[model samples]
Every structure is written in structure tokens, then in C-alpha cells.
Target chain A: MSEPESDSISKGKDGLTIHTVSKDRLLEFMKDMKERGFNHLSLITGVDRRDYVEVVYHLHAMDRDEYVVVKTTTDNGVVPSMTSLWNSARWDEREQYDLMGIKFEGHENLKRIFLPENWVGHPLRKDYDLSNVQYINMDEDGEDYATFDQGDGW
Target chain B: MNNFVELNFGPQHPSTHGVLRLRAKLDGEIVRELEPIIGYLHRNAEKLCELTFYADNLIFFDRMDYVASMLMESGYLEAAEKILNIPPPERVLWIRVIMNELSRIASHLVWAGAFGLDLGMLTPFFYCFAQRDYILDVFTEVCGSRQETNYMSVGGVYQDLTPEMIEHIDAFLQSFPKKLEEIYRLFVKNDIFISRNKGIGVLSKETAIDYGVTGPMLRASGVNYDVRKANPYLVYDKVDFDVPISQKGDNLARFLVRFEEMRQSVRIIKQAITKIPDGPFFNPKAKKSMMIRLRGDGEYYARTESPKGEFGVYIVGDGGVKPYRVRVRSPSFKNLSVLPVLAKDQMISDLISISGTIDLVFGEVDR
Candidate 1:
């Protein structure tokens, strides 16, 4: 699994090595990366590309203090989860799913972390309607519910 | 029939600290499974940063780690400056080190004091807060704010330190170590505190690395991975200091690591003062007007060792005044992700101790 991914490897202007891999091979590639001492999963972010969503993973080797950015593009906004490799991915993936609308396949509990379940649309998306303000109200069970009508809230 | 009691730890409880909610399933006093439900304070900070110019995001960055606003501002500025390719003058570099260290110490004071209150130690809370106010006074003198000081800019600082301000800082630096020693004795030597914290919430090195827990938490596990020492930035290469660590990896170890870090900050500030040179602090090219219209096309992640951990700001610019995307690698968010691992098989009371050791800042976590 640790073979030279020469075709996918490219250097960004930021001076970090980047590996651009397909969605299906991402998990295996990451598994190989973890084996090669990229033990620390620094941060995971998803950016809207208008047509397709690009997911970025910043990995670091603690002993060597080296870093690499792993990137994958998904037209459907679904990528394999790294939760199996790193426990911290569970929350980071959830955040991406919550805001950027990128779904992590095979995640344990992929739920909205920063917004209510009834939230209208992913706020980070470029097409997200920011003018339509959503308010929250707590019911008898103390669970928050998102509402579009202002009167229905607090 | 199962006797698992479901509990809501906090959306409002004092110990949970600042709108963080932990949904836990408890079998008597032992936690079975826990889910941390956040977003009460999520104001779409990342999304907001994407919409505004890079310079405009400084205030928003300050809000994320309000306790250590200067550190947040500095980290964000570092990344933005990298893309803009603005290397500040030597004097600005030394000033950055001084301000960043003071911010680290102030943040640790808040964490130490609030942590003591969680364990019902009230006197330390007042002592630590009173000590923290002096640091805030220095900040107020610099930027006229007690907490959220908008002092840092992209290439340099908004204002240079006056002579009176430097004397104030020197006086505080001279007197603060003895005060920190007093705070240390109050928490470290007490038998009750030791019994509560020692051997509790032991985070192994592998687990700490896997979860990306940086700063004192990782150091507590004997991982010598400080961003300052590992990849020195902004004159950190010039400063002399030790990266204190312990192999115990317990709650007390984490406490000692941060407590020691406060003293080290004092040491760094002292060195920075004498080494600082006289020069223009602000880069003329990156003035306010230029920052508003500054357009860069590239991506860079600038990480700094903030008080709590390794705080990084990743900026991707698309040849526009505003950044294409801004992602914050919040230390607390990553550290808090391993809560279940730390809280597992411990008494419910120990949960507070573990969390206190972890140092949860919900603004950064939820943002």
C-alpha cells in the first residue's frame, strides 16, 4: 500500500507535499500514510468547489515534524471515513458534514454537530441562503428545534 | 432490565463551562457512553471568515479563543501574512513573542483558576483571576481592551509599545514568578488535590498522537512536540527555553505541564525584552488600506503553540481580496474529541477532573 504515488504527488505553493487521490483509494492511501509515521491527524476540512466538493486532510508526523496535505474530490460530496484509522476523525468529519455538507461514508454517528437536525441547508455551501434566518426553540424535552418563523422562537 | 441512567452534563451547568453539553449514559457513577453536543455558540465563524477580507477576520478569530485573544489573532495573522508574503521587521518579531507568551500565561491562569473552582477550591480561583487581571491591564494599555485585544495585524502590530508599557511589562515579569509559585503550591502540594488528580485520566502517547492532542496535554504524555521547539517561528529559534514534559500522562501531569509553561512564558518574555531592537513595527505595504484590498493566490497553514495547544489557521486565497476558504484547526476541538477515551471507566466525579485537565474552550470547539 505504500508504493510511490508519483502521479498524484504534487507540491503546493505553501511548500507542503500534497497527495491527490481518488475517493475509493483514500482509505487505503491514508492507511499507508499512517504506517509511514504520519501518526497525527491534524485537521480535516471540506471546501465547496461549485461543481464538486474537495476534502482536505492535514497530516503530521510527530517525531519528524513533517506535514502532508491529502486531498480528494467528490462530485457527490461523499468520501470514505478515516474514523477507523483515527478516532479524532469522528468529530472532525461530523463538523464537515454539518457545515460543508460533505458526507463521510461508514462513519459511526454522522450527525449535525453545530446545528439542530432540522436545520434547512448546509450554511457553508456557496448557494446557502443566508437571508433566510433560522431561529431555535427548546421544547418540553429541552431539545432544540430550528424554525424559520421568528414568532415560533424564543 | 438495564439500569443505565441517561444524563445531560451541561448546556448551562457551571462545571461544563460555557455552553458545552455532554450527553452521558451512566451506570450508577461510572460513565458508559458519552456524546458531546456542541453548536450553541457556533456563529458560523469559518463561513464568516470566508465572506470577509483576511484582515477583517482578526476580531472573529479573537472571539474563538476569547481567553487568549492575542494568540488567536497572532496565529491567523501568521497564515495570512504567509500568503501575502509579508516578512515583518525584527522588532515586530520580538514584540510578537512577548505578546504571545503573555497571552499564553493569561489563558493558563484562566484555565487554572476555573479548573480549581470545578474541584471546589475557591481561593485559588480568586488568586489566579487577580493575577490574570494584571496581564489584562498590560493588554488594555496596548489595545484598550481587557480580554479581546485587537493588537496584531497581518504584517505587524496596530501600535508599537510605548516606553511606559515596556516598563509595566518588565515590572510584571519581575513580580509574576513568585505569584505563580504561590498558585502552584496551592494546587500541587495539597493532599486532597493530589488524590483527586493523580493517576486519573491517563492519556497514553499513542492515543494523544492519534487524536492530535497538542500543547501541554501531549507533553504530559512525554511527547516532546512543541511547535515552538519543533518548527520555530517568529524568533522562537532565538529564545532559550525548555519544553517541560512528563511520562505520567495523568491529570496532575497535564496540570504540572501548563503550570510550568506559565513560568517558561515569564522566562521567554524576559529574554524578548532585552533582545528587542528599535525599528518600525508595522510594514508600510500592509497598512490598513492595503490589507483591505490585499489579494493573494495561494494556500498556507500557519500554526503557533497557543496556550492550550497547537492552534493553526489554514487560508486558501483565490486571487481575491477575500479568502476562498478559511479553516481553523482549533486545539480544544481536537483535544476534546478524545473525551470518551479519557472519561472511560472513571467515576462520574473524575469526569470533571479529566475535563478540567483537558481544558475545554467551547467557543473554539464549536466555532
Candidate 2:
């Protein structure tokens, strides 16, 4: 098949306009859109599709009263960060890294935001084992206080 | 010689409010750099929602922004209703507007009181709380619960407004203005309060938009963007209210914006009460116990103007009872992200006032 359009815009199931941009041209597309009045970066999140991860950016053009969702799918779970373009993307990118394991290259601080630094696995990934539970006792002092169990609650 | 000392502000400090830890690098009393460490109250609300049915997740929405539970519930229910393609009756819409505006007032009342306490003024705290209690009383009368009211459902509200509840709310509307005026006299015009907050923690309009701040904080920076006005949902389009804006973009600006917003909310509520038609509050077809099945393979995002800011909910349905993915784009999370930027080069003492002005509720921030 011939190469699909690098930048394709479609209306989402809801009212938002969805724009799918190629990973390589994502930064350029976002910059162009921003210059075109999509100044507000409302939300940045990721969806784990089992086969691949989809990174989603919700942008709003305040003056024009327009909202758009820019998304890109990645098999390797890595995408370019938009922190250089919008400061709002920093915390959100870190969150996507923590929960969905989608790494954003060139992010200033890419680390687990909601979970501990020593967290073993991403919780939102489909392959992660939810039954494997770990409990940390903050009152106790050492490794003995932290316990891991399979399908058990303390 | 330059000496920079690292200091920890919260996760326990009273002024920090709700377990927010700020690791600040201080040179003498002035802050050089600050980092906010969050997630202490994280309950994995987004992760847990994926395992729940459409209607069952409404309660979890309440837990996120406990200060403004009704607004949180409204956002989630609106998103689910959109995905399921269910529009509630006119009466339900009118009642929802009334409740939402009332919740907005209540949330602002708490903020006003807490913010006063943060500024070292105890009298205004009691005065604002006294008024807030009256609002909570009305909530309890209507929903049988005050703060964490899981009253909103997928297609409509869980209960209808009774005449006694209407009378109670009317009484509140009549008396709240006097109390608000008293609060204004107590703090808003006070010189000490003004001096402390007038120019501290300034966030410019460009900076606010770049960092994606919303609600009063964004409006304080002179941005006339409010979800209710920008994109009206429910009966907000019909109601007449002004979106308050300030050019100062400082602590005082944020305070004044919220104060004016409370008056506007009252205006919306009063209009809603008069315009609400006599009809069924809920859609007759919406069953109480049936699992709400959304359209397959579709994603929906819905947002509402909460007391704090724009609370958006994104849900993906896969033709199943449970959602494929549920994400809460909480305003507190985004607003708190700008703290480090705002606190830079400010006195360490100013950090408390700045954080208080941001009006963070860690439940929403950590979720």
C-alpha cells in the first residue's frame, strides 16, 4: 500500500477533532497547530492498546473556541516530549511514563510521578499483574515492614 | 559567598494544606528553586475506574475532589452520558445547574475561610465557615449527605428536589449575601491582607496559559476562558453570569476572582430556580440497577467548570459494562505543576500564601 497521509485529522466519536500525526513529524505538527491558535495544552495521557501504546494530547484554542486531540501510536512505547513547546506537558509526560510506561524522549524530568521510585512495574499496562500486591508499612523501619504477596490483603 | 539551603515545606505542614510536600532550595529567606512532591494521597482512582461499571464509578469521582464533589461527579456523569448517548430531562438539567452552582459557592466558601486562616486572620475563617455550613446544610437536606454527595447518576440525578429543599435553598440565597458582605468587610478590604497578597507570587497571563492553569487562577491572569462560558453544558447556556477576570495575576487577583465568582454562581442559581420547568427529573427509560452499556469502541471527553478549575473526564468504552480506560484530567494536578515556577525568587514565607491561593485539594492532585 502507498504511504498514508502523514497528518490526518478526523472527528472523534465525541465532539473533539482528532488529528493523527506521524511520530517523526509530531513536533512539527504540534508547533504548526500551536501557531495556528491551539495554545492551551489541556491534557496529555496515554492508552495501552495491548498491541501498541497511543499517546494523546488534548489542546484547546481559547480565542476560536476549538478543541483538538493530537495522538500518535508507538510500538516501542516511546514518543517525543512536548515540554519544549508547552511547559504544561512536563508533569503529564511524567505521569504517562509512570502509569502506561510510554517514555517521552527529551523530557526534562522523566520519572515515576505517582508511584515510588522503586516501583517494579507500570500499573496501567495490560500485561501487568494486578493480583501481585505489595504493602508498605510506614511505621516500621526496614525491609521486614514491606511485604509482597500474591492474591492476599494485609 | 553564596549559600543555598534546602528546605522541606510540607506533606505535614498545616499551611501546605492536604499533604503537599514542597522541597525548596532557599538562599537565606528567599527561595531559589522549589519542587512539589505529590502522590501521598494517590488512590489509583483512574486505575480503579477501569474495573467498575459506568454508574458505579460516580462515587469514586466524589473522592477525587472532596472539596467540590458535585462538580467532579457532574464531569464524569456528563462524559458517561455522552458515550451512552443519553440526555436527561429538562428538569434534571435545571436541577443540576442549581446543585452545581450551589456546590461552587460551598467550595469557595471553604477556600475563603482556609485562605483567611493561611493569611493569619482567624476571624474571617470562622465567618466564612459559618456561611459554608449553611450551604452544606442545604446539601445534606437535598442529597442526604453534605461533602461527598454521590448524587449525580449517568442519565440524571439520583433524587429530585423537594419543596422543603427549595425553601431551604431560597433561605440560603437570601442570607448568604449578608454573610458574604461581612466576609468582604472582614478580609477583602483589610489592608494587612492586601499587603501580604497584592503582588506576591505573580503568574503572568502568558505563563498561566503556557502552564495550562484554569479557573480563577487563569482568570486572575486576565484570561477570559471558563468552561461554563467557553463551552456551555447543561443549563449553563441559558443562565446569565459574568466570567470575572483580573490583570494582576497575583494572590490578591486570585482571591478577588473567586469572590466575584461566588456572586456570579449565586446569580446563576437564582436564574435556574425561576426557569426550572415542572417535569420529570430523570429519563424514564434510565433504569436504576441496569448496567449502562456505552457505544462500542468509542472515546469521549467531557469537562465542567469545577470550583477549582476545569475538571475533565475521558472514558473509552469497548462494548462492555466496564470502561476500557478512564482518565481524570484534574485541574489541581495541572495547577499545582506551576508552583515551582511561581515560587521561584520569592521569600520562603510567601510560599504558604502562594500555595494557599492556588487552592489545592490533594485528593484531586494525587488522583
Candidate 3:
């Protein structure tokens, strides 16, 4: 289901227009875009929406010299994956899983990317803990530091 | 169908390039499929940029492309300057050019050394470092910090380049071209080197650009897209140098492009040194008060031709001392994007040669 050519999609930063498309039609949208010459998938980043998680795909069409931002949001637990369309989305989605706790369904080998498999809690979450967590001293001294409370909740 | 053996190349192995881990399935010596596992060395560089002041962001920028720290620093500094609407003086731009060129030479030298070492030659590593140490020494003289230099401030440099330091750079530039020829003659023509690199891991122009591959890797594919040329920044337009391109797009071609790039850097420096105008360094209008003023708010993308590729800095300001959001579009990340596609159907032995040709510093790739 291709949107009409005359219809201008949602416009965001840098004059980039955000287009909303149904998950079922994503692959067709991508193929239609390729036919129209949007060949470059510049960046694939994820943003956290309180009730759900959103995935943003930034595609730059070399032929048109314009950028289009396509967004896909998933329900709280359902992971709507788009790896089949853009292979580059695989790692970017895995990273979203690791940091924002958003899983990508149908990701061939989805796993923790930027964080250790044993790490607890998604650090990038707004409610993620900043205190009482272990931190490594990268510079000198070679000390491992943590801010865990030793007494009753103060 | 089930003849392939699965091999986990690295999470810690030396040849995998940085902390990168790859799971490859091979049929005899030929790689059937390869999955790149990255983010081992991630430090959330983007998030770190948001926490620091606009001027202080250079400190972290250097570490992203550790091989070409000056280019990364200059890229960020130029972007911040653009957002603030402040133009650094002529001398500062010249200094930025000189430092950037020197860093390019240093980065290529390290790449040469590491590539040689990867291919089982030890002499080039030592020889490359011997020259690299001199560049580091020059960096220490001007910036007072060698590797991690927050030297390039938003409107200008940390300090002036002393005449003595300029003489040292001039002397090095004069002798460096000869050393470059010597290294090339020793390494490039070697039979084993030729055999290892001749036709290994080929990437086409369409794939390279689609993956947003920049710098030498893209140039090796016969695509003449150098940010310095297509997107000129920081006085790159005033000076002249040819962007060497190769059609092979193989491991050897990538190596050749860097070799020519180092030579081009020298040419640019020679011209820059002769024509460098004498003037003040930093912009006086730049906020020098205890509380730095970030007067305007806007998003700016400044990309420079880093030794590795096009290192881009995307900054979002809120008219405050600190950036509201900062995103670093690292070349290594985009360069590594094509690895899985390229590595498929190649031999396991060719993996190192292929990865070496890309020359990704994990600090930038995983950052």
C-alpha cells in the first residue's frame, strides 16, 4: 500500500519527513522506496515510548537528495522486527534490546550487543538505576566502585 | 549441506581487529557465512557527549578514532563552531590542517604496521612505530598531550603552535616522504604480501556507498567521494590535493589507497605550510567567561575525512553550556556494516586480510 506521491508525510528535524506505515506493509514499502530510488539506509536507531518502543529508520535517497524517516512502534511486549527488509537493522535492533529492553521478533540471532549477557536491567531506560550499580575505573587507581546502600533505605 | 564447521573467531582473539567477535561457518577453507559480533568496547560515546560541555566534548571525540584523534577532534570543533556562528582565525585553521594531516600520516603508519604484523611480518610494526613516535612527540610539544588531546577548542586551538614545533613538523615532513617510499617498496612488492592481498574480499561501489562506507574503503571501490572534496570543511578548499582512487576494491586496493592518501596529506601540508597566514588563533568573541555561553540552538552535522573514513558529528544544542544531544556518525561503524555481506563465501584465511584492509579501530566502531 504505497502512500500517494503528493501526500507529504510527517516532517521532523532537518526537514526530514516521518512516514507511518503498517508493519504488514513494511517490506512492500521498502521495496517500493527502492524502486523510487531511496537506496541508502543511513541510520537505524530506537527511541523509548512509555507505553511502547519505537524503531526509527533513516533512509537517504541518492537520486532525490532527500531524507525520509520511517518509524515502527511495537506494543509493550510484542517485538516487531524489520530485519528481513534491511539486514543492517539486525544489529541496531539487538542494541535496542540490550539498552532499551525492546526485543526484536524474528531477529535471526538477537542477543545482547552493547552490554554483557549477565548484566541486570537495561541501563538506558529512564527508570534505570544510576546508583548502587558497579562501575569500573578506566583511568588510574584500578578501583571498582559501587554506590549500594549499606543501611536501610535512606 | 552440513559440511561447514562453525568457528568463533574472536571476542578476544588478536587478529579479529579490536574486541570484535565473529562467528563464521566454513566449508573446508571457504567461509559459508559470517556473522559479525560487535559492541565489546562500547562506552556509550553518544551519551557521554550529551553530558559534557560543547567545548569539552573534544576530549571524548579523540578516543573515538584513536588512530586519527586530531581529525575526530577537529571534526567536533568545526561543528561546534558552525553552530555557535564563530569563525576561528586563519592561524587556527592552518594549525588544524597541519595537525589533521600529521594525524593522517600517523594513522596510516600504524595501519601499515598492524597489517604487516597481521600478515606475519614483524619489522614493519617496529619501523612504523619508530616514525609514529616522532609524530606523537610533536603532538606532545604543541598540545601537551599525546594520544588523548582535547586540544582543539570550539572557536580555536588549545594554544599556539610554537615556531620550534613548526620547525620539527617541517623537518619531519621533508623526511617522511622518503620513509613512505621505503616502507612501500619493502612491503608492497613482497611476494607473500601480494599473494595474501591480491584478490581477497572484493567490495563493489554500490555496496560501499549503500553501507555508507567512506574514506579509503570507498575510494578503493573507485568511488571518488572524499568528505574533504565533496563536503569541504576547515580550509580544505583553499589547499589542493588529488583524492587517489582504485577500482579493485580488494584488500590490496584498500591498502594502496591509504598509501596514496598519506602522500596526498604530505602534499597538502607542504602547500599549507607555505601559505599559512599569520593571525590570532582563537576567536575573541567566543565566550571566555567562567560560565561559557551557548547562545543559539540548532542541529549541525560536520563531517571530516578522518584517516579511517568520514567521521561525522551531529550536535543538538539548547542554548546552554552543554549539548542537549550529541550523536557521532562514526565511519568505522558504517564501514563494518558491510563485513557480513563481504565476508560471505570468502576463505577463513582471507578474513584477517579483509578486516585489516578495512582498518577499523574498535574504539570508533563499538563506541
Q: DockQ values for all predictions?
A: 0.78, 0.76, 0.30
lDDT of 2 at B287: 75
How does each model score on lDDT?
Answer: 0.89, 0.86, 0.77
- The number of the candidate with the highest TM-score is 1
How many clashing pairs in candidate 1?
0
Q: TM-score: which is higher, 2 or 3? A: 2
lDDT value, candidate 3, whole model: 0.77
> For model 1 chain B, where is the 10-residue window of minimal lDDT?
B288-297
**B102-209, model 1: which lDDT tens digit per residue?**
999999999999999999999999999999999999999998898878899888998999889999999999889999999999998889999999999999999999
Model 2 Cα displacement at A40 (Å)?
Answer: 1.3
TM-score for each model: 0.97, 0.96, 0.85
Q: Write model 2 residue lDDT over B209-327, tens digit each, in one string.
A: 88889999999999999999888999788989899999999999999999999999889888888888988877765677554544435899888999888899988888887889998
Tens digits of per-residue lDDT for model 2 on A54-121?
A: 88899988778788898899999989999999999999999889988998999989998988776778
- The residue pairs found clashing in candidate 2 are none
What's model 2's lDDT at A125?
89
Best by lDDT: 1
Share of native C-alpha contacts between chains A and B (below 8 angstroms) recovered by candidate 3: 0.32
